[model samples]
Target chain A: MAPDQIVFWVFAPVSVGSAVAMLFQRNAIHAALFLIVNFFTLAVFYLVLGAPFLFAVQIIVYAGAIMVLFLFVIMLLGVDREESLVERLRGQRPLAIVLGLGLAAEIFVTARASLGLARGPANFDETVNVGGNAQALSHVLFRDYFLPFEVTSILLIVAAIAAMVLAQRRERTTVEAAGEAEV
Target chain B: MKTPISYFVVLSAVLFAIGSVGVLVRKNALVIFMSVELQLNAVNLALVAFSRLHGNLNGQVLAFFSMVVAAAEVVVGLAIIVNVYRRMHTANVDDASLLRW
Candidate 1:
């Protein structure tokens, strides 16, 4: 097998394994760590897929910012205690397992069926053009996709404000409860 | 020889399924949120794979948008989780059923 295929084989298992580990981990912190591993492996996959810009963003945004946010909440709430695995709703676990398996089978069959089809358009090539991955991505993102890009920025701003508002409300309620208790 | 796109698609599918199972079985809202992130990552992988297959950058661009949305989602989601914890003193989803008739 070629080196690329070998590398893909190795990291594919690593990513999937860590995801499974995240699911079974009782402590929220440990689960977050496992997810970081999964994200890192996925970043490597992005690199192999020839999207260098996506690789960088996957590492920076996902492995760095998002994971830190998850860890912060896990620590702040101290909800790291083990969760009771017992299902509150009857048959939830069994139903989930059955559905997951069915989904997996469906995807596998579809993938196998499509294996014989021709690859994408012949004019398309994987190599970087005169510019690099970042340049090409920026060209498309800033020009053709400008509207969605701007909208994404707006969504982020709204989310930040919402977060601050929610946190402030929590603080206010806590202070009010403490004051009432003192009175 | 080029790696078959089907391999990447299959991997993405499996990861997504694992994430779905985590969402279903995990009780902690934080962990459930992480599972959702996993699912999102799976979708990003499929997007990138198809981008490579088609020799276009659109899929990668969409993946970038997905990541931005995910970051914003995490910020809002974690804040809501923290707020829930503050009010209920627990992260268990079942415990937060204040609207249950």
Candidate 2:
């Protein structure tokens, strides 16, 4: 088998296993650690997909910044809050399982339904080779996707302000959750 | 040599399913949050895969933007979780069901 196939086979199981392990982990910190493993695996996938820029961003942002934040919050909350996996709601576990399978089927069909998608990996290699992957992506990012890029800055600033407000305000009112403008 | 795009599509589907299941089954608020992040990462992986298949960078750009959104999301989300814990003294979603104190 090709080295590409080998890498894919290796990381794919590892990623899936770690994510599955995370679900079973009652401890938040352990789950966070499993997620870190999954993130690193996805970063490897980014590199394998020829997204060198995204690979770096994945590590710096997802693995570094985001995971750190998750860990900090988990630790602050304390680890003893391990959840009891019992299904209080009748058939909740079976229901969740069925829903998960249905979601996977839907995603599979929808993703594959698109036409013009390739069978094997694409060959933007020449483009990527032009002064390397970073240079090529910079062109697409700055020129083609300029407007959305600029708008993201606004979204980020707004999110920051919302977080600050929510954290500072002392209240149990669930209305404060409106500030939860998450995603 | 390149791996098949189908591999990534399948992997992403499976990962997303796992993430959703995690969200549904886990009672801990933080674990649910992590499950959400896992879902996002699964989509990101698929986006990168599509970017490779199309021989274009558009998908990657979208993925990048999603990452930005995710970062912002985590910040606000964590704050909300912390606040919920402060008031209810527990981060379990079922326990914090009431909209108000």
Candidate 3:
């Protein structure tokens, strides 16, 4: 196989397997750990795409910062693994499965249709500037995509306030749990 | 010359499907959260693949934005999950019947 195909072969299975493990693992902590693996694999994928900056950013921002937050919540909440996994599927599960299958099928169909229409790999020589850094990316992000950039900031601010509100809300009256009734 | 975009697309699609299944089958809120992250990563793969295919960095730029959004999601989602766990003492979706149907 070719080099790019080799890269895909290595990272793709890793990413997909971790994702599956993240789903089926009964332990929340274990699932989060599996997600870290998935994120690292994705970072490798970014590197292969010629976005070295994004690769580092993916690791630092996602695996480092964001996943730490997840770990913190998992430790703080002390969510029970056995009980959490045992919960029965609700009525919406069937619908969710159907929707997901439909989405996957649509993508498969599109892929089949576009089989021979694959575009050539981008020319790094023409796009590469003095240092081959993310020059074009910086230009577009600042110039053309500036509005979306600003909008994302606003969206983040909104999400922050909403999260704070959620975390701070107090329960005026605590209802006794059901399992305790047996004791 | 051997870098076919189909491999990337197939990889991403498989990952996305796994994530969707996780979201559908898992009851633990944390697992569900992780699954959603997987889906986001899958999309990132597709974007990066396109960027490589077109020889432009626009897809990479979009992927960066996606990363930012994912960071925001983790912060907000973790806080919300922690709060839910505190009140309910469990993170099971079935137990989260604040709006029971």
Best-fitting candidate, measured by DockQ? 1
Could you tell me which residue pairs clash in candidate 3?
A: none
Per-residue lDDT tens digits for candidate 2, residues B3-95, read 778779889989999999988888888888899999999999989888877777888889999999999999999999988888888988887
Error of 2 at A1 (Å): 1.2
Q: Tell me what TM-score chain A of model 2 achieves.
A: 0.83
Model 1, residue pairs in steric clash:
none
Give the lDDT of residue B64 in candidate 1: 94
The best candidate by TM-score is 1
lDDT of 2 by residue, A145-183 (tens): 899999999999999999999888575577667667553
**Which digits, one per residue and each the tens of the lDDT, describe model 1 over residues A11-102?**
99999999999988998899999999999999998887887788899999999999998888888888867998787889999999899989
Of candidate 2 chain A, the 10-residue stretch with the lowest lDDT total is: A114-123
lDDT of 1 by residue, B1-101 (tens): 25677788899999999999999989999999999999999999999888877778889999999999999999999998988988999999999998999
lDDT of each: 0.88, 0.86, 0.79
Worst 10 residues of 3 chain A by lDDT: A80-89
Best model per lDDT: 1
